[model samples]
Target: MRAIIQQFGPALESIALEHYTPASLSSSQIQLKMRFSTMNPSDLITISGAYRSRISLPFIPGFEGVGIVHQCNEQDSAFSIGDRVLPIGSAGAWQSYRNIDERWCFTVPNQLSDEQAATSYINPMTAWLMLSERLQIQQNMTVLINAANSAIGLMLVRMLNHLGIKPIAIVRRDNTLQEFEGCKLQRIININNRDDYHSLIKMKHHIKVDAILDCIGGGESLMLSSLLKEHGQFINYGLLSAQPIPPQFWLERPDINFSYFHLRQWIHSAEKIDIQNKLNEVMQLVYKGIADTKISARFSLKDIHSALNYIQTNEETKKGKILLTF
Candidate 1:
């Protein structure tokens, strides 16, 4: 089997494609023939040693992917040979094959294409959980979201529109405004202009936001929090700015409720049946074209370096997800 391994050193220098023998599966495990995986910011962060405490050396870097059941033990009744499934919550998805515990895999729906199933878990699930579980968003309520052009942000917009909730999308660039062309319930606020922050404050009169979904931390997070209704929630999931929020920012906003979301922590706490149900609901939305995965580009495993470079250089204009096809 071929795999992308992070040996030691910087992200670009450490990553290398090599052959390895996959281990035999235990009674509780099943072997997966990887079909496709995604190049997420988290995957790159891990490779760059930013997540050193959680990952050891010489480890494979992908976090999620879609696969076919190449082999399965008889005792594992949940899966069978030739089953199309998603290997969830396990590392080494960047490889051609993986042996994962049966509990970690979920059968993919026939309605979805390999591209959809391949990029399933992270963005969609995160958006669903943030809207349904964390904020408990209700119809007619207004929700504020930063990084509104991101994959997760777009998912949130569609879901909110379906539920009759209004979404205020804050973006850094003017060109991104075109992405929300048909979204009736969406209000695009460009933060690039100094006056847009005041525009948001003015919007508070017409749109009483119940929660603010913030992925861009640092000054942007603090500025977005100011627009939230009194006692409204501020959920932070990513640090795109790579800068920590100053302690004074929190100290200043005593009335606004702030929380952090980590998908792994939520998965660990929720029941498997509940997780499956949520995923199924999102999958149905995906099938209906309500929740869609937009692919900006695709690359082979051998071209991992170029793929990473594309994402790093075109951070602003890259409007969709990047996939790695095996």
Candidate 2:
């Protein structure tokens, strides 16, 4: 089996392509031939020692992907050989093949294509959980999403729209605005400059959103708080700037309900049944096209470095995910 191994530290330098014999199936295990895995920010960031405390070394780093079941050891399992599934559990999606427990494997609906199924877990599930569980968002309420053109960001946009809620998209470039051309977004605010606070003020004048979904957590996060209503839900799901939201951010707006959401945390603690059920709901949403993202490009597993470089340099034009095809 061929896999992208992360044995050392700090992204591309320590990571390398390696071939090894496949490990035997353990108890309740199912073997899968991987089809496609996304180059998610979480996957890339983890290699940079972001979650070193919880994640062990010499580990595989992909969090979400799709594959066909090649072997299922359990006779009573819902999955069968030839079933296309998202064999999720541990982070090993970067490999051409993976051995995972049957419980963690989710069968992909026939309605979704292989590429769509590859991205099934992370963004769609997170978006659903946030809107339906974490934030007490209601119909007709307006919400602002920074980095709104991102994969998960787009999910939130479409899901919010489907639920009859207005979405205000905050993107960094004018070309990024093209991502929202077909969507019926309430407003699209392009922050061309670091000092572009006037556009924010104009949006505030029109409507103080009930919640704000912040992905870039630095000066921009603090600036966006002005658009949220008093005691509104201010959820931070990503730190794109690699800068933490300081203590003063809460002190400045004590009434704003600040919260940090990590999908890994929820998956670790939630009941297995609940996880399966929620994933099923997310799949249904994807089937209905309520949660959808464009595939910007794809790369072979050996070209991992090039894929990383592409995502880095093409952020302005990246309306969707760049997959790593196995």
Candidate 3:
């Protein structure tokens, strides 16, 4: 079998696609033939040594993927040989085959196809948990989400709409304007890397949102933080701009409730049952086409470098994902 290994340093410096022999599966474990996976921002960030404290040396680097159980000992009633499952928790999905304990994987719903099932975990669960746990948003409350063109951002828009919370989108591309408009989203702020942040930030004068789900932190976060109503929720789940929050940011909006959500932390701390139950709920929403995703391209695992290059070139304009297959 072959796997992408991370031994040290940043991703470009650390990751390598290597062939290896697999150890025999244990009675308590199931051997899986990995089928599909996707490269996410979180995957790049971790491999780039952003979350160094949380990472261990020489580990695989992927959070979500689906696999077919090829060698099952019938230890778990929920899964058996030839079952399609997602190996949840921690990282190690960037491989051709895996020998994982039966308890760590969950059977994928028949409703989702291989492409959809591959992306079923990360974006869906992260958005759901933020709305269901951290934010105290009401149906009529106004919510603003940055990076509204990305996969997770698009999902957030739909999730908020389903909850009846008014969503104001801040996106980076103009091509997505018509797409969001088609959905009847009332407010869409389309800005570019060169535009003045203050000029585009006119939400405060028009309306005060109750909560802001910000993914692009940095100066973008600084300006957006000002638009939140007093004591509103400001949840920062990503740093797409590769910058930190300005030191004086908090002094300006001390009344705003600021918090960070890490799906990895939640996965490690929450009971397995809770994670499974939450994922099932999100899958049902996907089945209803409420939380669907798009795909821009698919690549074999061997062409990982080419895939990364494509992601960088089309990131600002691309509305879909880059998938990897064995």
- Find the candidate with the highest TM-score and give its number: 1
In model 3, which runs have C-alpha deviations exceeding 4 angstroms?
9-13, 173-175, 192-202, 316-318
Worst 10 residues of 2 by lDDT: 1-10
lDDT score, candidate 3, position 274: 85
lDDT (Cα, 0-100) at 10 in candidate 1: 62
lDDT for position 108 in model 3: 76
Q: Tell me the lDDT of model 1 at 156.
A: 84
Better of 2 and 3 by TM-score: 2
lDDT of 1 by residue, 271-299 (tens): 87888888898788888776778887888
In lDDT terms, how accurate is model 3?
0.79
Using lDDT, rank the candidates from best to worst: 2, 1, 3
Residues forming the 10-long window of minimal summed lDDT in candidate 3: 193-202
lDDT of 2 at 90: 77
**lDDT (C-alpha, whole model) for all candidates:** 0.80, 0.80, 0.79
Report lDDT (Cα) of residue 234, candidate 3.
92
> In model 1, which residue pairs have backbone atoms overlapping below 3 Å?
none
